[model samples]
Target: MDLKRLNYFITIVNNKSYSKAAEKLHISQPSLSNAVKKLEHEVGAPLLERSTRKFALTDAGELLYTRATIMLSQMDIMNKEMKEVIVGGKGEVVLGIIDSLKTWLPKLIYNYKQSYPAMVFKLFDVLSVEHVKQTLQTYKSHAIITNQLIYEEDIDSIPLYKERLVAVLPQEHPLSKKTTLSLADLEQESFIISTEGFQTRIDIINAFKEEQLKLNIQFEIDRFETAVSLVRNHLGVTIVSENYVMEPIDKTVIRRPIDHPFLERTVYLAYMKNRHLPVAIQQFLQSVEEHFSTNKPL
Candidate 1:
């Protein structure tokens, strides 16, 4: 019931033994035990099963442990946010980003730091569309930059910019001679595309389907570099965001713009619609909007 007792209960569950929890908490075993007992009495549930030698949680104990951990984590986040407001110094931003956005995401993050020198950033690579949505939904990330269009009603999305998709082909492929390529043109070519859950793969498929073309997908890859490697080895071709093909781009593969309207991907900055964002995070999002609004190069 009380924060102190709940914390004590969580510590005991985490350490798995009274002696270890006591040591970690810098308290006597009896004191730790008393705290947990008080918590059990307050919650009206037997938290631990004493029948187990290594110690185990009762069904109720497991539930309490899960809830307490999440509660404590939110409390900590609130405390940090409050400190940032009063002290104007320390704060952290947890962000989820798709791989392709790395082309300019690092710079955007760096620019944010210039305004708030003490800002801490936790960057997570979220490539698959489903994974990115889950990251935002679960509050794992405050905001995300993704290549897919999320249709979730509880998520708010901001359009960043549209980047053209390009065809990556083997150096000697006859289609490489063209300045631009269409899905119909590459229908007969072996394809090395992203995995099934990836937005890139879905977009690629839709683009081809629109033209009534069938893709001969020979391989599935996660990274754009991997696609280049496969194409270089004469395995198959791939379609990906333009910047995904990093510079110092090798000669063994060639990139030509894809001509389909559906192939142009719009990057999005998405976040939980109802979540309260910390001020630092709000400013970071603002900077992104301003940059793209002015047509400044990312």
Candidate 2:
């Protein structure tokens, strides 16, 4: 099969619909359909089972889909390598980071750029751990800086740092008087918590259970800022990573680490283990390690 047809096949699998893939590639639907048909004929098997309701890939199609993803990625890497030979290692670096990580990332990116003047750095705030894992799996990002580790067969992680979870309470709350309170002390206390799917949520919940305490979740918010804001208004308390507790401290909000469970979140730099990273990204990784080793953010 032609490389064009293979590229089209990868797009179709990614979009999950021939029509949607056609629209994205700016090609006519009939032309895209013909390409897939010819590909199926050449393979002597149907790649996609088309039904009135939805598209499903057959077993052979699923295998081909996985292999095609890697093949296309390798081809793209080869093309970039050829270009880099002429232009040097000066391509864009796409980094996916957890939303809460923005606090100190500016410093890291600044240091990286000073060292590698030619590479353009693009930072994207990925909201969830699963999203970062998906980006790594699909070659959407060169690297991910995140607080949570997601289990994926193809991805590898480098340990970066640990972030402790601190309790945010209104300055007037009775719990604010304690320098450090036990998780058991917060049992039945009203809390503004992040939604349940987050791995951080799981960590907090497990910690509470270990302390024989039950969390009374008053509100479920998606953003870390929302949870902090609510606690500032005296709505309830919330558990948040230390990196998120930036100051000029709101006079109304007080932060204290929980002493009983003593929970801390680990941050990792994730990338596809087998994927060949561009030279610019390799230099960036080195700079990141150097920045974190000596500098402690204020």
Candidate 3:
């Protein structure tokens, strides 16, 4: 199969319009249509359902799209590896991490860099587990440290650590003195939470729902630090991972474990399953495994 035609087909599917794909590919619409026709002739099946008002893929097209995407990704990885080899095999490592890893990620990077001083590191802090998975799938990130256990055929996840979710409140709040807290206990209090797509936010919402209670959300922030800061100002109470509780007391914020139907999440180090990873990425993964094996904080 011609890679160019395959690319053309993938581009058309992605854009969902022959004219748009032609514009993006710098080709005439007739040429693009001819290429797709040739592809269908070669495959012996129509790849699209043209009768539909909106662009739609036939069953064969759907299968080819999925396979073609994987093939293109593998080809891109091969080209990148070849380029790295041609340039003496040094490459940058990109990592996507959740906000809770802020405390330990820097230390891990610093220790890993000591051995490979020339290695370059790029980091992206994302809130949603799906975002991390998408980054790995698109080859935008080499690895991800996240709390979401992504179960996909093309991705592999390794258990790193488990931490409980706890409630954060202002020191002067009436419930702050309690040794333990429950979602029901905060029924009257306003809740500060992360946005909907975040796993922590979903988990917190589920926990509240289990008690047949709904949080009186007053604020929805993206980061845990922001939620903690809001808690300090007595804006509302928030729930966060235990790992995110940094030292050096804020003096105004208090953290307590939630009781009854304990909310806990497991952290995982995820990577592409069959892709050829750079040496720096492999080394960093190994270092992370070794470091966390004995030094798991929670």
lDDT of each: 0.83, 0.80, 0.85
Candidate with the greatest lDDT versus the true structure: 3
Tell me the lDDT of candidate 2: 0.80
Residue-by-residue lDDT tens digits, candidate 3, 30-53: 999999999999998999999989
Of the two candidates 1 and 3, the one with more favorable lDDT, higher being better, is 3
Which 10 residues in a row give candidate 1 its minimum summed lDDT?
A: 80-89
Q: What is the lDDT of residue 213 in candidate 2?
A: 78
* Candidate 1 displacement at residue 171 in angstroms: 1.8
Candidate 3 RMSD computed on C-alpha atoms after optimal superposition onto the true structure: 3.2
Kindly report the root-mean-square deviation of model 2 from the true structure over all alpha carbons.
Answer: 3.6
TM-score of each: 0.73, 0.80, 0.83
lDDT of 2 by residue, 1-298 (tens): 5888988998998888888999999999999999999999998999997764677898879988898888888787777556655655667788987656767777777777786777887788765777888777777788888876868878887777887888888889988888998887788678887785676788888898887778999999878788888888778888888778855567888888888444888888888878767667777876766666776662
- Cα lDDT tens digits, model 1, 224-291, are 77888888999888887888875647888888987789887788989888776667778998888888
TM-score, ranked from best to worst: 3, 2, 1
Model 2 TM-score, all chains together: 0.80
